[model samples]
Target: MARKLNDIKSDVDEKRFLFHQFFYKNIDADIEIFISHLEKLTKVFIFSGIIRDFFVFKNQKPFRDIDLIIEEDLVLEEIFPALDFKKNSFGGYKIKFKTVDIDLWVIKKTWALNQGQLKFKFDYLNALPKTTFFNFSSILFSLETKEFITGKDFLRFLRDKKIELVLKENPYPELCIVNSFYYSDKLQLDMGDKLKSYLKSNYTSKMNVESIQLKHFGKILYSDEYIRNKIEEMFTN
Candidate 1:
């Protein structure tokens, strides 16, 4: 049976101490391993649900997937299999490797043409943007580094000044169509599992989400009108 949200919350609150105790042990060790591996790769950034959970949930639960973005297609094609990931085509822009219930995604460069792929071409050494909550700090591998980003940093990242907001237009229309199509048919499915499959089927169609892997298109193009219509259509069926 699906766990009730309140029941889960109450149980978690009571055993909060246990959660903290186990957290330091496994969390510290896992982060170390992730950091060590990340340092060895070239031009890589982390993304997707795992990134979402880390920043939003503070790594409280074990993350289900480890999504990565590599600049080189050769590295994605050659190295993933060696690392025990079962690679498969994902839509047109991403790849998936499943481990347990975790679904990792990898997006190659040129994944976002509409976002002026130029945004990605900055000199990593000279132009690495100042760290922000969602873009930089949450893209972390070390628990130590995680601690360095305080609540203040989060506020700075999320705070929007009405006059200064720089919102770029979304680039992927076809990807939106494909994702909407996938979710409509699979109401019970965890999107992580079928992400790549849905993507590969419509590879030629342009997708707007940026980043190298598990990039979320909804953030860019999912408007109020779009979501409301989708929901209404779902119930009507």
Candidate 2:
């Protein structure tokens, strides 16, 4: 049986052990293969949604993809020579191993930081939390040292089941708005004050629903009228 995140103590070592166990059990790839390749890098971290989902839903939810951040610049071919990898739309490498799909990129090339949507500070890992659109996606787990790095509100918001916006100025404001609705509906989370305000302010004539659907979901998951109604209900209620 998979260990529950709540059962583990707050100690870093204990959390690390639990994270390792979670990784091994949930991921279909060979653990040793990833660990060995990851160890070769200067600094690598498994960040964002996967870590958050582990804490929130445990192993009950299927992970969409594993997001990895590598601090150093290196060719994907050189690092994981054994595995087949390809470039994703967001300038990251995508690898499909068994039932899992991994998306990895150099830390410097992060979409928000690279595109100047967010500034990159001296500490990349510390600055990472600010790049995400939501607090739940702000957590980072170091693959090398096995330590978690997160924004102050990350755990709190998760525990409270609240959706808070971490960064207001994102490249995809429309997508962020869509995601806020999607996550709130999927996770049964309440919108934080900031998120509520953001939704109210941004859900105006500027938002292109069709563009958001194509860019984010790749297909029409929510009808145009349904999306408008949902956004209307979010702010009005």
List model 2 lDDT by residue over 1-237, tens digit each. Answer: 533334332533356768867776776546447856676766888887777777777655466878888888777787678886888666688887776678888887877888887656687778887788888877788877778886656755655668898778876677777888788887888889899888778777656777778766788666667777876886576
Which residue ranges in model 2 land beyond 4 Å of their true spot?
1-14, 30-32, 78-84, 88-90, 117-120
Q: lDDT scores for all predictions?
A: 0.35, 0.74
Give me the overall lDDT of model 2.
0.74
Cα lDDT of model 1 by residue, 1-237, tens digit: 544445533443444344334434444454445435644764444443443344344564564444444333444335444444344444222333232222333333223322243354554221212222122122222222221112222223223200111112224445444444443332222222132333334344233333312454334445444544544554465
Number of the top-ranking candidate, with lDDT as the measure: 2
TM-score of each: 0.37, 0.82
